[model samples]
Target: MKIRVLIADDEQTFRETFSRVLMEEGFEVTEACDGLQAIDAIRKDPYDVVILDIQMPGADGIKVLRETMSLRPDTRVIMVTAFGTVEMAVEAIKLGASEYVMKPIIFDDVILKIQQQWRYRQLQQENTELKTQLDGQFNIDSIIGEAQSMKHVFETIYKVSGTKSNVLVTGESGTGKEMVARAIHTTSPASSSRFIAINCGAIPEGLIESELFGHLKGSFTGAHVDKKGLFQAAENGTLFLDEIGHMPLSCQVKLLRAVEEREIWPVGSTQPIEINLRLIAATNKRLLEEIKEERFREDLYYRLNVVGIHLPPLRERREDIPKLIHFFMTKYNSEMGKECVHINEDAMQVLINYEWRGNIRELQNVIERAIIFAEGDTIKVSDIGIFNAAAIKNDNDEYDLHNAMRNYERQYIIHVLDKCDGNKSLAAKSLGVGLSSLYRKIDELEINGNRKVTNLA
Candidate 1:
C-alpha cells in the first residue's frame, strides 16, 4: 500500500511543490493550507506521516502538532521551519514531532525524513501488534494444566503480578518459560506497556551489550544512529531475558548495576538513562552450578532471583498429560480445521507413559503432527508415528525396550537441536543437560552428522 502523507503549510507554492514531489514518489499526499485545516484533515482521516509547517495561519505548527499527538499518538509528525525558527522546530520535536525540516526545504531531505519516519512508524505498529498478540495468546487459563505443580505456579504468579519485583523463571526447554513471563506481564499493573523478550544465547557475543543497553551514533563500527536498547524500549513494561545463563559475564556486571541503580549507560554515552521496568530472566541451566563453576555472577543471580518461579518437567506431572493432550487437540483442531479429536485408549496410554523430555512444547508438536497425518476421525497410534509399535505391542515381536527408548531420545534431542538452529550448547542447556553430557548422548545416539551442529566452539 502507498504511504499516506499529510502536508500542512500556509505557503501555497511550497506546499504544492512538496506535494508534487511526494506524489511522484508514490505517496498519497493531502495538502492543508492552515493548522486548523490540518487538524480537521487529521481528525477526518488517518495518515501515516504528517508534515506541519511551523508558521501555519489558523492554529500554528506547535498547536497543530499537539492536537495531532493528542488525537493519535502514533502518528509521525515532522515540523517545517524557516532557518531563523530552528528553535521553534526543536520545541515541536519536544512536543512529539518525529523530526524537523528547515524551510527552503530541499525536496530530497524532506522525502528522506518522511521515509524515515514512515519506517519507524511501521516498526512501532508491528511491535504494538506483537504485544497485543502475546497478551491475547497466553493467559493464566491458557497454561492448560491441573497438576499440583502448575497450580503452585499459578498461585505464585497471582502473588507476583501486582508487584514490581524482578523474576527468575527456571525450567527445562519446551516448558513454556516465556509463556509464564508473558502471563505475569499481561496481568500486571504495567499490562498496557511493552513486553520485550530477547534470547541471550541467540545474539552474538559482541553485539549483546549494545543490544541490551543501546548505543549512541558512531558508538561502534556499525552504529550509524542513536539506538534505544531493549531495556529502554521496554520502558514502563517488562523485559524477558530468555536463556539468561548464556549471557556473557562481561555484560553481567553492567546488568547488575542496571538492576541496582535502575539506570543504564549506553555503549558510548557518558550519561546514564534512568530505566523504569520489570526484569524477568529465564534459564534452564542450574545458575548456582554456573556460579560455582565461575561462569555466572553470584550477586547478579541473587538480584534476578528475587521472586523465583520454577516449572516442573512434564514427566514429574504425569497426571496432567491427558489434560494437556485434550487442550492441544482442541487447540490444533480449531487451528488446522481438523476433526481428529478422540485419542484411542492405547494411544493415550502410550503418551501418558512416555517421558516428555521436551516438556509441553514437544507434546504440542507431536499432537500437531499427528493431526496433520491422521486419516480417520479419531487420532490412532499409527498417526503418532513414534508410538505406533510400542502402543500396540505384538505377542510374537520383541519389545526391544532399550532400542525404543534410544529412538525416542534421539528424536527429542534432534528436535531441540533444530529449535536452537543447531547450537549444541544452547540445545544442551535447554535440554537441562551438561555440555559434556549432551555430547556423549549425541555420540551414544549416533546423531553425529545426520543432525547438523551450528557451532562446535
Candidate 2:
C-alpha cells in the first residue's frame, strides 16, 4: 500500500506543490490549508504521516497536533517551522510530534524523514505481530491435555501465574517441564519482559556460578570481557533454571544467598547488584533424594521450592494419548506439507498401548515420522515404525488374528511396490495379480497412488 500523507499549512502554493511532489513519489497525499482544515481531514480519515506548519490561521499548529495525537496517536507528525519559531517546534515534539523540519522547506530531507518514520512504523507493526504469535503459542490452552492430572496442572498454572513466588517443577525427562514454565511466564504480569532459560546440567560444573552471577573482565581465566548473568538479563522478567539438581553444591550456596537477598555479587565485583525476577527451576531428578544424600543443599531446596508443580509422565496420563497424537499430526502436516488426516484403528491402539519411555517428546517424534512416511491420508499400523507384534494383542489376552493378517498384507504390498519403484503394473505382474486388482487392493488398503511408499524393511 502507498504511504498516506497529509500536508497542512496556511500557504496554498506550498501545500499544493508539496502534495503534488508526494503524490508523484507514489504517496497518497491530502492537502489542508490551515489548522482547522487539518483537524477536519484527520477526523475524517487516518494518515500514515502528517506535515504541519508551526504557525497557521483559524487554529495554531499546537492545537492541530493535540487533536492528531488524540484522534490517531500512531500517525507520524512532523512540524514545519521557521527560525523565529524553532522553540515552538521543540514544544511540539514534547507533545508527540515525531520530528521537526526547518523551512525554506528542503523537500528531499522531508521525504527522507517520512521514509524513516514509515520504516519505523513497519518495524513496530512486525514486532506487535510477533509478540501476538508468541503469546498465543504459549497460552495455557495450547498445551494439549484433557486428563484429570493435566487439568490439575492447568489449575495450578492459573493460580500461580499471578504471583511472584519461586516455582520448582519436578518431572521425568521429556515430560514438558519447560513448557509449563513458559506458559506461566507468558501469562504473568511480566509477560512483556524477557524469559531467560539455562540448563544447569548442560553447563560445566566449574562455570555454573559465572553463568548465573556474571563476571567482570579478568575475573577468571578466559574472562576477556564483562558479562551479564542470566538473572540480570532476565531482570523484571523470568529466569528458568532447568535440571537444577545438577547444579554443583559449591555454586548452590551463592544461589541461595542471591535468592534470599534479591542481590548478586559478580565474580570480581565488590558491590552487589540488586535484582528482581521470578525464578522457575525444573529438574527430572528427585531433589529430595539428592538432599538426603548430601548432593544438594537442604536450605536452598526449601527456598527454590516455594511452590511446587509436578508433571506426570505420558504413561501416567494414558487417556490423553489420542489428543496428543492428533495435535502432533496436525502440527507436522502443516510443517511438512502433507495431508495425513487419520490414524487407523490398529495404529491408534498400538500408539495408546505402547510404553512411551521418552514421554510426550517421543510421541511427537513418532507422529512426525509417521506423517513423513505415510502413503495415504490415513496412517495405518504399517506406517508406525516403533512397535512390535506383541503390541497388537487385544485387551482380553487374545491376539487379533484378523488385524495381524491385514497388517502383514499391507506390509507385503508395500514391499512389492518398493521393489517395483512404485510401478503398480510391474508390482501386479510380479505378484501374479491383474493391474485392476492391484488398484483395487491399493484403494482398499488406503494407499495413495500419487506417492511412493517408503520401505520400512
Candidate 3:
C-alpha cells in the first residue's frame, strides 16, 4: 500500500508544492491548512506520516506533534515549510517528529526521509498484523490446563507480552516450556519479526558458537561459505534459547555479551554486528543453583532472569487431565482417522490415578498410543496401559483414593495459594469459590497446618 500522509502547513504555496512532490513520490497525501486541520484529519482516519508547520494559527507544530504522538504513537511526523530554529527542531523531535526540514524545501532530502519513515511504518504495521493472526491461529487450547498453576503461566505471558525483557522459563522436561516461549514471542511486540529457537544442549560444543552467532567464510574448518546464525536470523524478533542450562561455559560468555550488549561478533569478523532481539530462555534446571555450583555464570543468570516463570509438572495438576485428554483426542482423532470421542470412566480413573512422570508430553504420548489401542467406541482402562499399579511401578508414586485425591488437591490449592502467597482470599477468588468454602475445604483436608500448605499460606 502507498504511504498515507497528512500534509499540514499554513502556507498555501508550500502545501501545493509539498503535495505535488509527495504525489510524484507515490504517497497518498491529504492536505491540511494548519495544525488544527491536521489533528482533525488524523482523528477521522489513519495516516502514516504527518508533516507539521512550526507556527500555525490555531495549534503550533510542537503542540500538534505531541497530541499526534500520544494519540498515534506509530505515526511518523515530519516538520516542513521553514520556521527552522534550534528550539523548534529540539521540540519537534522531543514530541516524536521523525524529521524536520527548513522552509526553502530541499524536496529531495524531505522525500528521502519520508520514504524511510514510511518503510519503517510499514514494517511495524506488518508486525502488528502478523501478531494478531498468529495469536488467533495458536489458541490457548494448544496448551492445556485451567488450574491455578496454568492460569499463573498464562498471566505471566499476558503481562510480559509487550516488552523485550529477557525471560527465563524454568520447568522440568516436557513441561511445555518451549510452547510458553513461543506464546511469549508471539504475543510480544516483536512477534512479526521472527522467533528463532535453539537447543543449546543439542549442538556440539565446538560448533555451538558458530551455530548461534554465525561465522565468516573460511573462518574455521568446514566453514566453506559465510553463514548467518540463529541470532542474525532472529534480528528484530525473539530468540528462544531452549535447554540453555546445558550451554558450555565457553559459549556462555559470548551468549552473555550478545544478550547484554545486543551485539554479536560473527566468526572471522573483526567488527561486531548489532542486533535487536528479545530473549526468552528455557531450562529444566535451577539456574541459580547452577550459578552457585559454577555450572553457569551469575551475570548471565541475572540478565536472563529479569522475568522468571516456573511451570508445574503435569501430575501436579491432574484436574487438567480431562480437558487435555479431550483436546488431544479431538486433535489426534481427526489426524489418525479415528472417531474416539470420549474416555470411559475406568480410563479417566486410570489417567487421574497415574503419576505421569513425563508431565504433559508423556500424557499426550500415552493418549496417542491408547487411542490407537482402543477398539471400542470409548477408551477403556485396558487400552490405556496405565493404571495405579503402572503409576507405582514406573514412577514410584504410591496412591489410593484418599491419598491420590489429597495429593491432587494439595498441589492445586498450593499452586494457586502460591500465586497469592497463601492468601485465602486470593486463592478463593482464583478457585471461583467462596472464601469460606476454600477455608472449610482447607480445614477438611487438614492442609492448614501442613508444611507445604502453611509455607504457601
- The candidate maximizing TM-score is 2
Query: Which digits, one per residue and each the tens of the lDDT, describe model 2 over residues 1-457?
Result: 9998999999989889988988899999989998899999999999889999999998899999999999998889999998899999999999999999999998988999999998887888799899888888788888988889999899999999999999999999999898999999998999889999999989998888889999999999999999998989999999999999999988999999999999999999999999999999999999999999999999999999999999999888889988898888888988998988877655676688777879999999989988988876877665778656534434553556876666556656765665565689999999999999999988987765654322221
Candidate 3 lDDT, tens digit per residue, 259-351?
A: 888899998999899998888899999888988899999999999999899999888888888887887787778889997776655356557
Q: Candidate 1 lDDT, tens digit per residue, 227-259?
A: 989999999999999999999999899999999
| Alpha-carbon runs more than 4 Å astray in model 1 | 1-133, 388-457
The deviation in Å at residue 419 for candidate 1 is 30
Q: Which stretches of candidate 2 lie over 4 Å from their true place?
A: 35-46, 57-60, 389-457
| lDDT at position 385, candidate 2 | 83
Which regions of candidate 3 are displaced past 4 Å?
Answer: 1-137, 388-457
Flag clash pairs in model 2.
none
Q: Candidate 2 — worst ten consecutive residues by lDDT sum?
A: 448-457
Instruction: Report, for all candidates in order, the number of backbone clashes.
Output: 0, 0, 2
- Better structure of 1 and 2 per lDDT: 2
